[model samples]
Every structure is written in structure tokens, then in C-alpha cells.
Target: MVQPVSTLNHPTLLESPQEWDLSTLYQGFDDPQLTGDLEQLQQTAIQFRDTFRDNIKDLTAEQIADCLKQLEAIAQQSGILYAFPALIFSADTRNTEAKQMQDKVLEALTSIENQLLFFDLELKNLDDARYAELEQSAVLQSYRHYFYNLSKFRPYKLSEAVEQTRNQDSLTGRQAFINLRSVHLGEQEYEPVSTPDGKSCSTEAELGALLFHPNAEVRYNAYGSVRSVMQQHNSLYGYILNSVAQDHKLENQMRGYDSTLHKQLLADEVSEPVFRAIMSGTRDRFDLWQRYYTLKGQALGQTIRTCDVYAPWDSQPVEPLPYKAGVETLLAAIADFDVNYARRAEEFFLKNWVDAKVRPGKRGGAFCWYIHGKHSCLLLSYTEDYNSLFTLAHEMGHGLHFAWISDRQSYFNSNPPMILAEIASTFNELLLLDYLLKQAGDNPALKKTLITRQLEDQLNLLFRQSTISRLELAMHDRATQGTFDHTFVNDQWMSLYHELCGDAVEVLPDHQYDWARIGHIYFKPYYCYQYTASNIVSLACYQKYLQVGKDFIPGYLELLSAGGSMDQVTALKQYVDVDLEDPATISAALKYVEGLLDQLQATL
Candidate 1:
């Protein structure tokens, strides 16, 4: 039998670092090396522009490759320069020095980007004969995909002067508004939540964790307290959302894209049909989502509410999974999949590359930030429940993906597109789920909990993410026609929630303003759909692993290793023989969820 949560012992918990060691990036913001690197980056960027500008059309294939190599060096430097302060600022959003340094770095990088903007525009504007000649060059083979992806933007290419103006204007334009949303969220205080112990103050992260509180009233009130803050500042958030959306719409008009979604998918190298396939397939399976929630309510002996969506099935508070235990569990799962994969992941923990502390002013959600040639760092407020454990696994999956890319690819290909980005992370979660389920053995409660968690995770990734993407489509459409306020956004969100939930759960009043808290809508517009797309891909990949066993390892690693070096669809097909373009592929992913739902029902 699996050990009880309360009795599971991990001695290393005492020695594990709570805060990440930023020393890997720099000693601190005050480190002279940080300053010197910024200076060096500026000098290198200037030299690049002077040498490459107005000369791309005259360069040979070898010269073009040399230019790209220099550009990649500049990009690597800029990645480190930006990542250092950005990671620090994320760790402590209230840190004035870190925030200021981040702003300075962003401004400097934007200026550098403006100076180098002509190179890409010139390449995009190259005559068909010249572009085809370069495309066939053996010397340029390494960067073939890179330039092919760039050429997709030719229709959207503005003149150099116009593009430069837009690039510089963004500091005060859309970007300034995005930063405002971040800073505003980081500063706001949520009302204290009443737990069984007592009434306690909460940060956004703390308040979020309470949604899983074993007590129904606590979950409801915590949800209200979190949303009340958003409702209170709904006007300001509405303005920020509208401003960002308007900026996107204006740019779409200027760049000649049909819509914001079109522009985003182009960058992702994902075709429109595949996007529609996932969204449509997900919407068609709303019944499975509703069925899971109904089963959850039955198991918990209460009507489901939005707040109770994450509540534990048992009425007992779950014992915290200490950071050390979480890391060990995660590593063991990966190691089970392949020892070499586990070895790559061990570096993050050994090198102190993760910040897993819960603190005020830290960012609320989790993210893995990978510096091109250095390493990846993860930031998450670890609340130490099963959710946090899975989150740890998820982000480490991203860290490992970056590690593979860094090991095998050039700096130019290190960053995968957003569509391919979440595959490793979600795949890691599945591995953890499988490991936990196997460990559960004849332990019914443990098995139920693990199965429920997996089902809910799939629901969120496949259904809720697509709902958010649908909302983005609606909001952006409204922006194109005119402007939308919080009221319209709220109504649309509730409508979509009702459509998806289908009376399986109670959609409360406060749930209407939930859109305010979705940072991606304000920051990234149409980015949420990528999670849905990736979840589909990862589920399919996991199924292949099950069927083929260890034989799946090589191709899976190759997919991650390919990084952004190839288009995601091509990589998926060539590596794993998974055709994302097929509607059956998407249906198969939903069927996988249905199979999990069947298991959960059998346990119930």
C-alpha cells in the first residue's frame, strides 16, 4: 500500500532551498557583471546593425549565415540581460530596484531591436528569385526553417521606418498597458479568508490556494474575496483590457492580417484548420467535462460550484507535499520514463534554478523561463498540495525541454513556438499521474484522488483553455467593431461557462468578473488556445508511449531536441508519427479523457 500523506517522510525537505539561487544569472541586480553585459550587448547590437543594414540583398549564402550567427550571439546576450531582472522582478514584484532594472533593460532592448529591424524587413522584401536562391543554398540549410518562418510575415511587413516607429511606440503603447496590469495585480491586497484555524490575510496566490480548502464555505468566501477585488477594480482592468485589445486590432489593420488570431497562429506555425479542429473537438465533448463535474459532485455529496471545482474529495485537509518530496516524486517519475531524462532534470534542483516559495508580491501562477544557451529557471508559489506537486512536475518538464534544445540546437532554434512549448510540460504531468496511480495500488482513496486530479487537469487544459480562447475571439471581434467594457466581457464569459458547465456546476455572480484575473488575455491576447492545442498533442504522445513502451523514448526526445528548428506539425509527424492535421487525432485526445472519466466512474 502507498504510504499515508501524513506519514510519508523525506529528510531532505529540511535542506532544500525555498528560494531559488539567482546567482546563476547574476549575484544580484547590483552585480557589475550585469552592467558590463548590458554594455557589451549594446555595443554588439550596434556593430551588427552597422554591418548588416542596407546590405542583406547583396550578401552571399555564406555571408547571410555569418550575419545570422552574429545576430544569434546578440540575441543570446539580450536573453540573459532581460531574463536576469525579469526573473528577479517575478520573484518579488514589489522590488522597486528589480522592476526598474527590468524596465531599463526592456527599453534598451527595444531600442536595439529598432536598430536591427531593417534586416528582417529586407529579407522579407527580397525578390522571389533571390529568396528561392538563398533557400536552396547548402550553407544556409541550418537556418532554412528560420528564414521560412520569417517569410510568412512578408504580407504583413511594414516599411522599415514604419516598423521601427511601431516597435519604439510599443514601449508606451500596448506594452505599457501590459506592464500596468502586472504591477496593479502585484500590488492589490485581497480580503482576508476565514479558515478553520482562523481568519487569515491572503495574497492572490494564497487566496487561490484556498479555493481547494476542504470546507465549502471557506472555498466560496475565498472565491468571493478574490473576485470582489477584481470587481472593485473592474473599471481599471476593463480599460487596460480594452486598450490592449484596441492596440492589437489597430496593429492587425496596419499589418494586413485578417485578425489577431490569424496573426498569432501564423507565428506559432499552426494552421487555421488545426486550431478549429481542437476548438471544435473540445466544444463537441463538453458533455464529458460536465459528466466529470457531475460525478465529482456526487462523490463529494454536494452540488458543485465554481469555487468547489478544486476541492478535495475527502473532507480532510491534505498534508503538504514538501518541496523536497515534490522534487523527488517528480524526478522519480521522469527517471522511470528514462534515466537520462531524469539526469537532465536533476540539474535544476542541484543548481538551485527554481524559486518555489510562497510569498507576498510574487507572481501568482507558474512559468518556466529558459535563457537561450544558459539554462531554464522556474517560478511558482508552492502551496504544497497535489496541485503544487503536479505544477512542479509541469514546469520541470519545460526546464528539461529547454535543456535538450540547449544541448543540441543553436541559439536561433532554442525557443520553441508556443504551440509546441506546453507538450513536455503536460507530458511530465501525465508521467507523474501514471506513477502515482500505479503507486496507489489497492488504495482506493489514493487512486480516486489521483484519477480525479488527472481528469480535472485534462478538463482545464482542453476545455477551459479553449473557452478562454473563444472569449479572446469574441473580445477581439468586439474590439474591431468598437470597444467592449467589463460588462460585455463578463456576460460573454458567463455565457461560455454556462455552455460548457451545463448546470453541472453553479456559476456564481463573482465568476462573471473572472476574466479580469486572466493575465494572458491582457498580455498575450490569443495565447490560451496553444495550451489546448498542446494538451491534445501531449495526450496523443503519451498514448504512443504506452503502446510502444521504451521505443517511444528516442523519438520523443528528438521532438523536444528539434526545438524551434522545425515546424511543430512536421516535427510531430516525423518524430512520433502523430498527424496533428487529422481531426481523428483531436478526437483521440478527447477519447483519452473519456477513458479517464470511465475509470473515475468505476472507482466511484
Candidate 2:
């Protein structure tokens, strides 16, 4: 039997320390300059396309450089084009104007993209030796990385009309399905979960916190409420997931991709064997996950249910950390290794570069949106819990990466590859954790809690994602063959959980529709494993930091500043001294996890 929750009220949530000032991007939806910028992009794109469409191959290298400059000018302003409406919708999804503007932006950009499509297509068609000469010229040297990477897709190139068809249909294809999923989720309002205190929560963020509630009964109730809500919409979500996967399947066949994951690997610029190396290392360490979960079960004095996996293994929950305190803590932690990181982090908060408010109709999770090619703005729905604070730091980490790389790399190489995108964010999280642990000093209970956090994050990032990658691979392969359904997803997902997480936790029935809720897989197929890859890579970076201290700072920062100047594997091997292809690197990272388990076991 569960202990009765107290029949009394508790503090709900603290006010957000600050709301983001989006003026850094633009003043608002109606800013006159917003219209001016969009018109400017249209004028620029048209002029460039008309000037270069028939003569890209015949143009001098200097002329090509001028064309690129005009193109980048249009590209830079696109931040306001998409980011403005996205910010509006994220804050208030019910706003019809915002929704209309989002549609408007997509349509407008599609036209501009359609106009610019010939540039790359025509360039790729240039005689191989001629293209080489162009790529090596002084004017094109900075864009060398861009042209070289673009060439890899030449084998998969289609006619300009076909490419335009693909681009146009995309608005109605997988992207539309993803939008439907987001709307479906955002529309849901879970029925309130009754508490022993007679209080209740129905919001996604609030109920999510209850999953880690100090009281097991509260956690169970919250979990039941969530599962019940998800069950009502399971078929809708299932349809969404199925349709999205099938979209990728059709495209995969069209493109002759090796498999669904092969395209992602190509985009990520990593090889299949290297990708499998991550999976293999995590697969070999099932014992470690089992041990950790078993210990957590022991701590809970009962079988660990899926709901209890993230439950705190402590005497009681820690007090919610304030937003201001969270910001200060993260800044101080980062200051030790790189004072500049702290400065960038401060700029995010100080310059109105973050949206930290939490309210109805706002998106559920945190994200860092890179504005233009210059800097990133963060969107966060901050709760008082430390985990939420970690979310803040995580997004800020992405902001710092964008800020650091902005001045160093041209727009062509400005964005980091998806595989390395999470590294800086995860790195920030590790440093924040370490700083918090040190701040705990001689408090054994606090240390245990910190260790528990470390384990949970590692298990999810390093292990669970690898397992999810298997499910994604299976789903895409099956979707290609046909007749895959919700039941099929449940079976495939459960098999992965059992194999990766073991029987240390019970898999409840409602958890079967898990695939329905994942936005990443739906948005970008075979995209889930980067979390696993990045976690292992970040852990290895942290290990080096411990061994070399501040001396390691320059190399790590350089890696971030390098952006997409080099592929992920080369960057890691050169800067962090770890190779994705090296199984030992994964094992070495696992050692840090093992040390945490050892410390937690000692406390027990």
C-alpha cells in the first residue's frame, strides 16, 4: 500500500527569473523592418538567380564569390523570416496570425530556395577537374569545405524540376506530418492527477516533475495520468509515426540510400562501422546498466517500474533551485575552464537572448535556436527543479557554441554537423554537475543525489539512445516493406528496452506508444543516435579535462570554433584525442560511469 499524501497544499512553482527579449532578433511580428527584411531577401534572391542561372559555369571565380556574397546576404536574413514566427507560435500556439505567418514564411522561403536551387545543381555539374580548379581558387578557398561536402551528394542528384518537386512536396510531406504530431501533442491537456494533498497537476512540465517526486505514490499517479492521456491519442500518434517513417522510406528508396540510417550517417559525416562502434560499446556494457538499476530498485525497496527509473534515490527530494541561482551556478562552473564561455552564457541571459517563461500553449521542451549565422537564442520553459536548470544550461551550451564559432567561420561552415551539435551542450552539463558536486562538500546525501543524476543522464544519453537507434533502424526497414503498425512499434521498442536495460525495471503497458512522442525520429529519420555518440564523446572530453585541467580548454574551444570546418571524427581525434572508431574510447568513457556507480554504491 502507498503512503497517503498529506492533505495540504505545497508550493506550486516560482516565477521565471526573466522572459527573453526577442528584440535582439526583431521587435515583433509587425515590426516594419520584418517586412523590409523579407522583401529584401526576395529582391536579393531574384537578382542573384537571374544574374547567375544561365552562366554559373562560365563565371569567373571572382564572379562566383560575388554571387555567394549576395546569396549569404539573403540567407542571413532568413533568421528573422523563420525565427520570428516560430517564436510567436512557441509562445502562443493559438495565435492565428502567428500560424499564418509561419505558413507565409515557409512558402516565401520555398520560392527563394527554388530560385537558388540551380546554383548548387549547376555548380555540381561542372566538369570534375574544372570544379576542382574553382574550389582551389583564392576566392573560393573559404568555401572549399562547402563545395567538397556538396560534391558527396552528386551521385544522388536529380533534375532541377525533380528537386523542386521534392522541395515543394516537402511542405506537405514528412514536415506536415511532424507539424500534425506537434499540434496533436500541444493540444493535449492531461486530466489532473489527484494528490494526497488534494492538489493536482495537468500541465506537461508539472506532471513531468512528479515523475521524480520524492513520494513513490505521487510518481505512480503522475505516471498513470500521463499513460492514460497518451493512450487516448495512441492511434493518432501511431498514425503520425507510421506516416512519418513511411515518408522516409519512400525517399530512401528514391535516393538509393544504403538504409534509413545510411543517409543520416552520410549527413553526419561518419561511417557505418564508426556508428556501430557506439552501439557495440554500449551493448557490451549491459551489466553496468543492470547493476545501476538493480541498485536503484534496492534503494526504492521495490521493483523499479519504468516510471521509477528517473525517480530520485534519496531520503527526500531536494529543494527546487531558483532560476537566478541556476544561471549564476552555471556561469561560475563554466568560468573555471573557459571564462569566455561564462561571458557568452551571461550574454544569453543579459541581452534578452533567451525565452525562459513557462505557460500554456508554449512548447514543452528547451531548445537553442541559432539566429542568422551569428549567435543562438534559447527557448526554455524553466521549472524550479535542478533538472530543469540543467535543461537551461544545456541550451545555453548550444548558444555558446554558436557564439564562439560565429566570427571564426564563414556562413558556409558556420553550422556544426548534427552529430557534434550536442557536444558543447553535454559538455556544459558535465561541468555543471561537477561544480554542483564540489559545492556539496562533505554532504554525503547531496553527493549521492548528484551521483544519481549523473547515472540517470548517462544511462539515457549513452545507453538508451543507442537502443533507440536500433528501434529506428528496425522501424524504417520494416516501413519500407509495409504493414508496420502501433503493435509492431511496441514489440520492437520493448525488445530494445529488454535487451538494453534488462529486467531491472518493469516495462508498463502504456509505455508501448513511446515512439509516438519522440519528435526527433519523426522530424529527422535515424537521428536519435547522435545523443549516444555525443554523450560518449563528451564523457571522453570530461575525462581529459580531469587529467589535464585548464590546459585542455583551448583544444575544446577550438573544436567548437572549428564548426563544420572538419568532419566530427577528425575534430574529435585531433582536439579531444578520442576516435569514434576506437572501441576503447567508448570503454574509457564507460569507466567514468563506473566510477560514479562505485561512489554511489559506497554511499549505500
Candidate 3:
């Protein structure tokens, strides 16, 4: 959930960089240069429309190259402009100035994007000879993927008049429904029940506190609060679901998508076989989690419930990790792989590159935003806990990944697809686990807990999230065929939960509306598959690093720096030689989970 725009009261996350510069985006949002860039981008988009909108169908080789280069430049600067304020606002959503800047830039950028929508349609309309001539050009040849990508959308293209209607509908059609739903859902208050300690909390705070609480009763209270609150507005949620699903149906029919998942998969540039492999392999390992809950239930001296699933196992007496120690620990872990990884991380830490403190009105979760080639900023609430340490390491991985890629590629080529975005960050967590395990040495209990945590990561990415993606596919498929109802969607969602959970533990009756709290469903449909896919790839690469020692660092570094210039599969193949289509990668991850189950059983 986003922090409200009225909550910010300080400058912890938005402070200026001490090492790298972000002035490339603008000296600040208030910078005159920022306004100049906006005006310039608008002018350039108009000039581009005037110069090539009609000429694309008859473009000579040189003219095609010029247009492509200009388009790339426009996109790169536009990204910087949006990136700066969006990142700033994400960290401190209460900053009205930042939010206003974000909205202003987004509105301006949307207009620019709309202006260029015709370029692709027009380019695809060219004769074979004209396209052939353009393709033969060196510049166009280099961007073959980009050109082919635009051509792939020719099937979805409507007539100019219909396209214009879609342009308007895109803002107010499904998107508007989604935005309206967001405003309603985010504002709906969930009451926090009285805890065993007799302390009161807000709904989200109680959930956060429950996950780490030593007492079982607190977890149950948190769960009850969640149910009670969600129940209050169940009908509103149902209405939102129906409206959004109908919106999607309207758009899908207009665009002529073969399947509901087809549009999302096409954008990802991956295949259904690969997605199914991850889902199936993860489902097969459901017993690993069943075993885990069995162990957890034994430790807790009772049956494990939905609320208990999140709390720490047996509440180990680990010390709180201070912010500096967390940063240093992460650096030491990265240092084991390569000096470059460690040095880059240290540079980020020493500079004002991270907003690590928690304050009122600040957003939750951690993210890394790359402002340009030279700089990035991390937003996180640095709680003094083991999980928070891992969070820091995870976001740092993203920051350094951005840096590595931006340095290696042209500005236009630096944006990786969302499917590959999780790789570098997950890789860091793998490295951190390796570092922690080695340090644990003969400490069986600590090692067991770490292994369990690792298995939990698998449970989340592969089993839980992958299952959610499948459910999303089903929901959207039904909606496309005119199936839009609250009860039907809720029933389907609950059925999916049963399949994924698979007797791991007894699911509470009230948990049927679990999908309601999952914001990703409303924002990015079928987006969870990437987490599962990346986990499969990360485990494979991490295992290789363990076996081959220093020999793997060069390949790993190359993978991080490869970025968006190449396809995700091609970039992954450079470091880890596994066919994503093959079931082997998923099987390997499941087998690793199976091994952990054995270790956990022995500890018990």
C-alpha cells in the first residue's frame, strides 16, 4: 500500500546524494531545467509526429535510422524525468510537492506516448521493400528486436478512429475503474483488535507486529482483525472486482486477444510452457511446506493456523541488527562473490543512496530507483531485525544491478523487462544465505532456521505466487467471456488457494477473501510468475557458484551488466546454462526444498 500524501514530515529518504549525482534528472523537481525538459519533450514529440507520422510508410534507410535514434533519446529523458519524482514520492507519499510533480510529469508523458502510438502502426503498414530497405540500415538492424516488437502488435491495431477511442478509453476505461477501486480500497480502514498485551494497533500495524510476535494469541487476534475489517466492506470489494473484470473484457474483445493471458504473456516475451513448468514443479513440492507447518505446529505445541504461518519459528533469541551492521553485513556477503559487487554496494551505503529510517507517513517495503547511469536511491524502513537486513541486501542488489546495466548499455537499452527484474535481487539473497550458513558453522538450530527461511522464500515465489498467477489467468479468461460476478470470482480464488496450500495447514474459513488484500492482482495481473521463474534461475545459478567457486563470478557479473540489451532468456543463459522450457530447472528447485525438509525433520 502507498503512504498517503499527507504523512511526510521529514527529509530522510529524499536527501541529496553525497557521491553520485541525480541532477541529470533535474537539480531537483523545482529545477527550471526540469520544466524545460518537459516543454522540449512535448515539442520534440510534435516535431516527430509532423516529420515522420505519414513518412514512416515510405521511409528510406537513413530516415528510419534518424527516427529511431530520436525516439530513443526522447524515451530516455522522459524516463529520467518520471523516475526522479516517482521514486521520491514512493519513499514519502505524504510529500504533496513530490506527488504533484509525479502527476504532472505522468500526464505530460502520457500525451507524448500517445503521439508515438501511430509510429508503430504506420511502420508496420510499409511495403515489404520499404521495410526491407529500413532493416538493411545498420541502425535499424541493431534495433531489430525493437522493430519486430512493434510489428507483433499489428494484429491488435485498430483503425485510426478506433485507436483514438482506445487512447481515451485507456485512461477512463479499465484504468479509471482500477484507479477508482484503488482510492476506495486503500482508504477503507481495517480495525486492529485488542492484543493479549491489551495494546491497540491499526490494521496494518497489527499485521506487521503479529508476524514477529512471540505470542500465539497476538497472531490470532491480528488474523481476526483482518477478517473483521474485510467483512465490513465485502460488497464494495465485490463491486470493484466486477467492474474491473468487465473493463478488462471490454478491452480484450476490442483488441482481439486470443486468450486472457495472451496479452500479458506477449508483453513478457515468454511462453506458456515455461510458466506451467514453474507452477507444476512448485505444486509438486507442496509437502515441503506441509512438513514445515507440521514442524512449526510441534514447536508451537498446537495446530498451525493461517495467522501463525507468518511468525518466526519458535521465536529465536537473535539480536536486533543495527542499520550500519546490516549494511556492512550485506557488503561482506557480496564481497565473497567479487570485489566489484562489494565496492559498488559500499559506495551506495556511504553516499546518501539509501533512505533507511522509518518515520510517520513514510511508505513501507523497499525499492531501488535508478535516476541515471551514475546514481540510484533505496527506500526502506530499517527495522532492527534479521528480515530487514535481508531487505536491505535485496534492494542493494537492485541498485547495483541498475548501475551495472546502465554503465554497459546505451540509455535506451537500460530498461530490462519486468520478468528479469527480480534476478539480481534474489541472487543477492542467495549470496546472503550462503554467507550466513558458513558463519553458522556447527550451530544446528540457527542453520535449520535459515534453511527454513530459504524454503519459505521458495514457498512464496514458486508455490504461492505462481498459483496466484494461474488463478489470475482463470479469472481474466472467464471475464473475457462475459463472466463477471463477485461470488464466482471469490469462489475461484478460494479454490486456487486450496490447490496451492494443499493440506500444508488448516486454512481458516474467514481466509476465503485472501485475494482481496493482494494489491498486485488489481495492479499487475499475472505478474507473480516472474518471482517463481526468477527463483528457479537463482537457485540454479547459486548452486553453480557453490560448486565452481571463483570461476562463476565473471559470468554472474556479466549477467547483471547484460540488462535489457538482450532477451531475458539469452541474458540468463550467459551465466546459467538451463533451458527455461525444460522441467529440469523447476525440478532442481523442488529437490532443494525436499532436501531442506529432510534437514528440518532431523532437527525436529
Ranking of predictions according to lDDT: 1, 2, 3
Q: List ranges where model 3 is wrong by over 4 Å.
A: 1-29, 94-97, 181-206, 226-228, 359-361, 372-374, 441-443, 483-486
Q: Pick the winner on lDDT between candidates 1 and 3.
A: 1
Local distance difference test, per candidate? 0.86, 0.79, 0.71
- The positional error of residue 39 in candidate 2, measured at the CA in angstroms, is 2.0
Candidate 3's error at 201, in angstroms?
5.2
Q: Report the C-alpha lDDT of model 2 over 385-502, residue by residue, as the tens digit.
A: 7788788878888988888788687677887887678889999998888888777777777677777987998888888777778888888888878957777888898788877767
Q: Enumerate clash totals for all models, in the order shown.
A: 0, 0, 1
lDDT of 2 at 250: 77
Tens digits of per-residue lDDT, candidate 1, 490-569, equal 89999999999997998988999898888889778678989998999999999999999999999999999999999888
Where model 1 places Cα greater than 4 Å from the true spot, the runs are 1-17, 199-201
Top model number, lDDT: 1
Candidate 3, residue 353: lDDT:
71
TM-score of each: 0.97, 0.95, 0.88
Please list all clashing residue pairs in model 1, or write none if there are none: none
